[model samples]
Target chain A: MGILEVKDVSKRFGGLKALSDVNLSVEEGTVHAIIGPNGAGKSTLLNCFVGKLIPDTGSVMFEGHSLLGIKPHQINQLGVSRVFQTPEIFSELTVFENVMIACFAKRDGSFRLQPFKTVENETDIVEKAEQMLVDVSMIEKRDMHSASLSRGDKRRLEMAMCLAQDPKLLLLDEPTAGMARADTNNTIELLKDIQKQRGITMAIIEHDMHVVFSLADRITVLAQGTPIVEDVPEKIKGHPKVQEAYLGTAH
Target chain B: MKILGLNEKDSRFLLIVIFLTLATPVLLQPFPEGSGMAQFNAGYPDLMQRFAIFGIFAIGFNILFGLTGYLSFGHAAFLGIGSYAVVWMYKLLDYNVIWGLPLAVVVSGIVALGIGFISLRRSGIYFSILTLAFAQMMFVISYSDLFGRFVGTTITNGETGLQVYGNDPQVLLGATEPSSPHFFGIVMRENFWTPQFGDWQFTFNNGYYFCAVIAILAFYLSLRIFRSPFGLMLRAIKTNQNRLNYTGVHSRPYTLAAFVISGMYAGLAGGLLAAMDPLAGAERMQWTESGTVVLMTILGGAGTLMGPVLGAGFIKYFENIFSKINDNVLHQWFAWMPDGLEDAIVWVLHFFVGKGWHLTLGVLFMLVVIFLPGGLVEGGTRIWRFIRGTDRKEKTADATHQPEHVAYVAEKEEF
Candidate 1:
C-alpha cells in the first residue's frame, strides 16, 4: 500500500459521471501532479481526497486511515492539507494573523475558546509560523493586510498558511492557474523548496505543462472522467494517448 | 499576551480608553444639567451602556456572519431569552445579582447552542430564514397569552421595576424573597445632589453608574475577543468557509462556540438591564431588536474592533434626539422663510424626520450601503485619508497596478 491510495473511486453528478473508476497511488515524500483539460475530473478527484465530495464507489486511505466519510477538517487533522486554486486568505486580516491562525489550529486543534489570552503568546506556534513565512519570503509583508498583497505575494502567504499546519500530505488544486510567468516560476521554486526541506508528499493539479515538467516526479493525465496515463514526468510527456486526449485540447 | 501580535502599546491604549470611559460619570460631575456638557453626561451613560450590550450582541452575530458568512435573523431570540431569564430570577430570587446574572448567562448559552446546532445545518439565505423563523417563534411565544395575558411576557410589577431594600429580611439573610412583599427603604428618601447653573443641572444616580460599570467591563471583554485566536478563526470562517474546512478546521464547533459566547454577552446585558430596573419583558426578543443589532454592527463596520460601539451610539443618539423634535421645533427653525415655502418645507421635513425618524434612518442606511459599505468607520477613514491627501494617491496607484477588467476576468476565471 502506498502512503495514499485511491481505489475505483467514482462520482456521478445527476446523469454525468464526474469521476469514474479512477485509481491512483501517491508515494511518500514525492511531488505528484495531475494534469488535464477543463472538465477532466482533476478537481473532483482532489475534492474526494479532502472529503469535500464523497465518491460513489471507492475507498481513499491516507496513512492507514479511511478518509471516505471524514470531514475536511478531520482530514487535515489526519496530516492532510489542501490549497485551493484561488488564493484563499483572510483578506481583512494582516498576513501574520492569517498564518498564525493555521499555526494555532495545528497546535491547539480546530476549536479553542480561550477568551482573555492572545494567540501570539504561544511561543512554539509563533516561531513555526514565522519560520514558514520566512521560507516563503513573506516575512517582510507579515504586517500588511493579506488582501493588499500582490497576486504572487498572496499565493506565497497562502502557501505559508498551509505549511504552518505541518501536514504529511498536501493537496494543491492549480496553484499557478492565473499567475503571471514570473509568479508561476516563483511558486514552482517555493514548492521545490518546501519539498526539499519538509519531505512532505504533494498532489498538485495543474494545466500548465511547463509547471508539470519542472516539478512533478510523477504525472497523471486525466481525461473524460478517467485516468489515461500515469507515469514518470518524462514518460507522461511522450505518451501517445495523453497527447491525443490533452494536447489536442490544449492546442 | 503578545503571542497573537498585540503588543504593550495597543494594550495600553485600550487601557486608557477604558479608564476614561469608566471615569466619565465622576469626571463630568461639574457640568450643569441640561447644558451641552451635562446632556453629554446624561445621554452618554445610557448610550455607552447600549454600546457594551449591543457590542456583545454584534460580536456574537459577527462570529456567525463575519466568520461563516451566515447571516442570522433570529439572534434577538437569544437576547430575549437572556432577558426573560434575568427577569424570572428577579421575581423568584432577590436581586443580589451574583446568582441571577450567572443563571441568565448559562441559560442563554444553552439556548444559543440549541439554536446554533439547528440553524448551522443550513447555509446562505436558508440559514438566515431559519434564524428569523426561530426569532419570530420566540417573539410569538413571549407575546402569547398562554403564559399570562395581563402580566405581559415580562412584568415590572410597577413602572419603577423590581426594587430591593437592605431592610428586607430575605435579602439580608441571603434567602429567596417570599411572594408577599411589604417594606420600602429609607435609602429612597434621601435626594441625591444635583449641580445646577442657570438653565442646566447635572444629577448623578447610583443605578445608572452601576449599569455604566458593567457596560465598560463587557466592552473590554469584547475587545479581548476581537484580538484573540478565536476571533481569527471566526474571520477565517467568514473569508472562506470551504478553505477553512480544507485546512482541517471544523467550522461548526467554532461557529457554535462563538454563538454561545455572544449569547452569554447578550445575557449579561439583559441581566444588567433587569438589575437597573428589575423587570424583564419578552418584548426584548422581538425581530426588530435583532435587526437593530445588525444595524449596529453594519453601521459600525462589521469586523472592526470599535465599530459596533460607534454604531450603537449613533443609533441611540438618533433615537433620543430625533424622537424629541416636533413640528413646532421645525416651524421655529424655518420661521424666517416665506410662509408658504416654510409650510411646504416643514411638511416635507415632517415626512422624513421628527416622528418619522425611521425614514431618515432608512435613507442613511441606503447611503451607507451604497457609498460607505464599510460603514461609519470606513467613512471616517476615507475622510482622514482625504485630509492627508493620500486617498487620491492610493487609488491612482491601485488603478495603475491592476486594471479593473483584468481583476474581474481573473475572478471569473477562478469561478
Candidate 2:
C-alpha cells in the first residue's frame, strides 16, 4: 500500500472535467513524478490532494486517514506540505525570520499563545532553522530580506522552510520551473541528498522532462484528464501513449 | 513580571517613554513666563493632561490599526462610551476616577467584542465601512437621546452632555463641600507644586501626573503586544490570511483579540478624559476624532514602537500652538518688515494658523503622507541615517514574514 492513495477521484468545473476517475498511489519513501502537457489535469489532481478543491467523488487517504472537507492547515498537520509553482516565501521578512516561523509551527502545533517568549530566546528552534538554512546553503544570506533574493534562491528557501517541518510527504509543483540550468542541477542534487538522508516521500508535478527523468523513481503520464501509464522512468521514456499525449498536443 | 512581554529593545523604548512622560512639564515650559515665546509653552496642566489622554487614545488605536492593519473608523465610539461611563459614575456614585475606569474598560471591552465579532466577518474596506456604520448608529443613539428624559433617564443628555450636577447621588461623600473629580481626595484640577525661576513659572498638577503614569502603562502594554508572539500573528493577518490558514492557524481569534485590546485602551482614555473634567459629550465619539487617531498613527509611523505617542504629541502640539496664534501675534512677527509687505504676509499666514489651525494640520498630514510615508518616526530614522552616513533601512519590511512562515512550517511538522 502507498503512503498516499487517490482512489477513483473525479473533479469537474461546471461542464469541464478537470480530473476524471483518477487513481494515484505514491509509495512511502519514493520520488513519484506526475507529468502532463499544458491544460492536463495534473494541477487539478494535486489541488484535490491538498484540500484546495474537494473532488465530487473518491477518497484521498494518507496512511488510511481520509482527507475530505478538512482545512488546508489540518491537511498540512496531517503531514502534507505543498510548494507552489510560483515561489510564495514571505517577501517582506528577513531570511532567518521566514525559517524561524516555520520552526515555531513545527514545534507549537496549530495554535499557541507564547507571545511573551522572545524569538531570540528559542535557541532550539533558532538552531534548527539555522541548520535548515545551511542544508539549503542559504545561511550566509539569513539576515537579508527574502524578497531581494534571486528566484532560484527563493525556491530553495521555500523548500528549506517546508523541510524544516520534517513532513512525511512533500508536494512540489514544478520545482525546477524558471530555474537556471546550474540551479536546476543543484536542486536535483539537493532532492537526491534529501531522499537519501531523510527518505522523504515527494509527489512532484512537472512539465520539465529533465527534472522528472532525473529525480522520479516512478512516473505517471496524464492526457486529457486521465492517466495513460504508470511505470518506472526508463520505461516511461519510450511509451507510445506518452508520445501521443505530447505530439498530439503539438498538432 | 516582564509587563507585556518586553525584550531588551522594547524595555529600552519603555524607559524612554517613562522618562519623556515624566519630564513633560519641564520639557514643555522652556522659556521665561513673561518672554515673547512664553505663549508657545505647552507646560500648562490642562494641555499636558490632553497630551497624556490623547496619547493613551492613539496608543490603543495603534495596537489595532498598526499591528493588525485593520483601519477601524469607529474606535471613537469606545472613547465616547468610556467618557459617558465615567461621567455617570460621578453622578450615580461619587466624584472618584478610580471607580469609573474599571467599569469603562469592562463595558467598552464587551461592546468591542460584539462589534468585532460582526465586523471581522468581513475584512479590508468592507470591514471599515461596517465599523463606521456601527459607530454612526451609536452616535445617533447618543446624540438623539433615545431614552426618555424622566429623572435619570436620558442616557446621553444631548449637546449639554452628562455633567456632575448639584443633586448628584454622591453616597460615598462625607464632606459637604462641592468636589471636583478626584483620585483619593487629590483633586484633578488642583496644582500641587508651582515653582518660579526668574520670570519662568512651572505648575505641576495631580491630574497631568496621573494621566502621564497611565500613558506610561499604556506604552508598556503596547510595547509588550508589539514584541509578543500574539503580535506576530496579528502581523501575519496583515500580510496574508490565506497563508496563515494553510499553515494551520485560525487567524480570526488573534485579530479579534487585538481589536478588543485596542477598544479597551480607547475606553480607558475616554474614562480619563471624564475624570479630568467630569463631563461627557457625544462629539467625543465622532468619526472625525476617529480619523484624527488614524492620522496620528500614520503621522508618527504606525508599525514602529514609539510612533503613536510621537504622532499624538506632534498633532496635539500643533493644535494647541497654532490655535493660540491670533492675527496680532502674526502681525507682531512681521512688524520688522515694510508696512504693506508685513500686512500682506500676515494676511497670507492667517489661512494657516489661529482659527485656520486645522488647515495647517491638513496640509501637514498631506506632506507627511506624501514624503515621509513611514510617519515622523521614519523621518527621525532617516535624519539619523543621514548624519551617521548609514544605509536607509527599507520601510516595506513588514510583520507578514513571521507568522506565515511559521504556519507554513507547522503544516510540514503536523505529522
DockQ top scorer: 1
Where does candidate 1 chain A have its weakest 10-residue lDDT segment?
Answer: A111-120
**Per-residue lDDT of B105-143 in model 2, one digit per residue for the tens?**
999999999999999887777778889999988887788
After TM-score superposition, the amount by which residue B23's alpha carbon in candidate 2 deviates from its true location, in angstroms, is 0.3
**Model 2 chain B worst lDDT window (10 residues):** B406-415
TM-score of chain A of each: 0.96, 0.97
The CA-based lDDT of model 1 is what? 0.71
The docking quality of candidate 1, as DockQ, is: 0.46
Candidate 1 pairs with clashing backbones: A73-B248, A120-B3, A120-B4, A121-B3, B33-B201, B33-B202, B67-B237, B67-B238
Cα RMSD (Å) per model? 5.8, 4.2
TM-score of 1: 0.85
Question: Could you tell me how far off, in angstroms, the CA of residue B284 lies in candidate 2 after the best superposition?
Answer: 1.5
lDDT, model 2, position A151: 84
Q: Where in model 2 is the C-alpha error above 4 Å?
A: A249-251, B1-7, B147-152, B176-178, B393-415
For model 1 chain B, where is the 10-residue window of minimal lDDT?
Answer: B406-415
Q: Write down the C-alpha DockQ for each prediction.
A: 0.46, 0.39
Top candidate when judged by lDDT against the true structure: 2
